[model samples]
Target: MTTTDSTTTSTGSPATAELRVDRLETVLTPTERPVPAGPWTASLVFAWRAILKIKHVPMQLFDVTMFPIMFTVLFTYLFGGAIAGSPREYIQDLLPGILVMTVAMITPYTGMGLNQDIQKGIFDRFRSMPIWGPAALVGALLGDALRYSLAAMITVALGIAIGFRPGGGAVGVLLAVGLLLVFSFSLSWIWTAVGLRMQTPESVMQVSMMILFPLTFASNVFVDPATMPGWVQAFVDVNPITHLTTAARSLAHGIPDTGAIAAVLVASVVLVAVFAPVTMRLYRSER
Candidate 1:
């Protein structure tokens, strides 16, 4: 007599046992699952995630680092004498302009990343998690603070190399940077909302750049408002970015613009108040 050995499963039935055993094989197999993180925990994840993206896409640094240096070099060499009458004076004047513009340009990327996340369905996954309700988004926005600080410091270092110096001592310098980050941080929410609502990241980029470019350029960046056309002068004087840029220049070179500093502070506070809540609302809806 010939005998065959077979394994028994949940059921003694031969065919059923084979089916059950096969199912068991699948259940026992290893599989991958995404880890769940809460809002606060998600914030930490988002922050590190942003850092990792920055590392992988090092080219993104081109705008913050290279843009300032290139523009400074080009403008100083090409238009310094014509515009400011001398390279040295141009460097001094242009440094503030470049720093402000650099910050302005770098900020839109905050929206770009948010838009990408929304498009990729990452936000939906975030919603499913029991983490801090808005913490992940807030953390992502905060992540850009590091980028802004790096850009600001690098731009100032470049300015120093080209003979620009902040007359404001260490305290003033710290204040200036603190103010810049505050302004940038608050402004970040507006773009974050845009990203959440928008479909394409590119659209967010274009719209943000259009809004930001004019704001920075129309400010007292490279030239005095007196030279601007009357209407332009009115606009420039009133631009909130002008106040901050002027304040930053004051902190750097002792320009004595107390009113500008106050205006910047007020505007930054307002921007944060207006946009942060809006962003959270939008995030809640989508979640």
Candidate 2:
């Protein structure tokens, strides 16, 4: 038989028994290592992550359904007669502008949401992962653009149901949709920059809405530019959304708006040139 002895210590006339202890260290090995990703592949991976996130959070769909109904009802019935001399004519005149407005306003969530993730530390996890550089952020932006496309199409469909018909054939309609997306994507880059730099998501929302509303409404969206006062018309003429709305209207009405298309192209190129580097820099600086 073996006996184990415990050491006792005396403190202030009281004897206390002490148990010996040892500290243990643990090491965990991952089952798999991250694989190297090509640039485009990494972008796609990040884009897919954003899409999956959208699936879990579905409040975004409300905007898709609501905007079309709201605008269609408001402009068609409320101010239609005052603006276009008839409600039906107003619907015809304003549908293209509304389509352009919807696309431009709704798509910024892509960049804004991504920026929120970064500000909230979710992006830190992605940064630590083996995802490709620029993939997580840029891919997320592009993925959100898909939502904008869907929303635009649905809104256009609703317009059709409400007596809005495009004089342009399928190809013209397709071109209009394509141009909306292109411009929206470009605009999103600016929001992406803002979101990346901002400390809170709410700030992003407020700032973005402040900028978007004036841009969308002050243009030829609900009213004709000819009816606008001179100062307002000057502003609208330079506004990128004006070009987009004009281009959409031209395509829908089967009219040639070569100047509007050129304006859209120029504005998109300028926005991309301005915001892309800024967003990327903000992304890297966030590290």
Candidate 3:
């Protein structure tokens, strides 16, 4: 360390004295630094980071890959005959419903992951950086969208292998998937908000699952709502998941259900509008 001598000086009134250092030095290094990244560039970098984590720990994908496949197969084989009289016949309706279910179930992981980041103090570290504030969260959401896409594709492929033939053909399948992705993307925001408000990752997981289970199970994903009790039918009638599943099925059959699709789209937009702001506010105020 450089040494300095301190001298004391008295003002003319002799009431106030100041201490002065002969030489002052600072710790800053003399180095040229590159310009900071733009918001989009910064977000993309964080997104790439999320992707790399998956590459290293491929098992993290089990929810999106294995679980979706498992659900599609198990439901088709075990309950197909009981529900629709034959596995092949049942799969036609079941595939579209199951795709919605799979994505709905998995979207909550976004919140749990956020809670984990906070627990590990990674969230604080990201917050202290000079980059755009929401980049980390935005990047994480984008990465999760990719996982949702993977689950959707795997579910569709497995359905096809087992006897699913969408009357709407490839175009209908693609349309359904596109609609599903938007819904999933919006749904993840709810979990993201919950994650920030919760004390632990487990709390986030538990709460998210609680909300999702009823939404997916109580909806018209399996049997027709008409088969359900009239009271239950009332709930199913307004369930967003029911709308999504019906729209998916309609699109898959080549006859689009404009009302259901519009409902799901409106729900998606509302979810993002409400939960996205809440998530961001929580993110900013998080300790």
Predicted structure with the largest lDDT when compared to the true one:
3
Cand. 1 TM to true fold = 0.83
Residue 219, candidate 2: how far off, in angstroms?
0.9
Full-model lDDT for every candidate: 0.79, 0.79, 0.89
In candidate 1, the residue pairs with backbone N, CA or C atoms under 3 Å apart (3 or more residues apart, or in different chains) clash, namely 38-131, 38-132, 39-131, 39-132, 40-132, 166-252, 167-252
The better-scoring model by TM-score among 1 and 3 is 3
Q: Give stretches of model 2 more than 4 Å off.
A: 1-35, 129-131
lDDT of 2 by residue, 1-287 (tens): 22343232234223223322332222343457667787798888878887887798877678866886687777788998887788878888788888887777776687568767876787888778766657876787778777877777887787788777788966677888888888887888888888887777778878899999999988988877897799999999899898899898888778959999999999999999998888878877745
**Global lDDT of model 3:** 0.89
Model 3 C-alpha RMSD vs. true structure (Å) is: 11.8
- On TM-score, the stronger of 2 and 3 is 3
Instruction: Please rank every candidate by TM-score, starting with the best.
Output: 3, 2, 1
lDDT of 1 by residue, 60-88 (tens): 87777888788788878788888888877
Q: Model 2: which residue pairs collide? A: none
**Best-matching candidate per TM-score:** 3
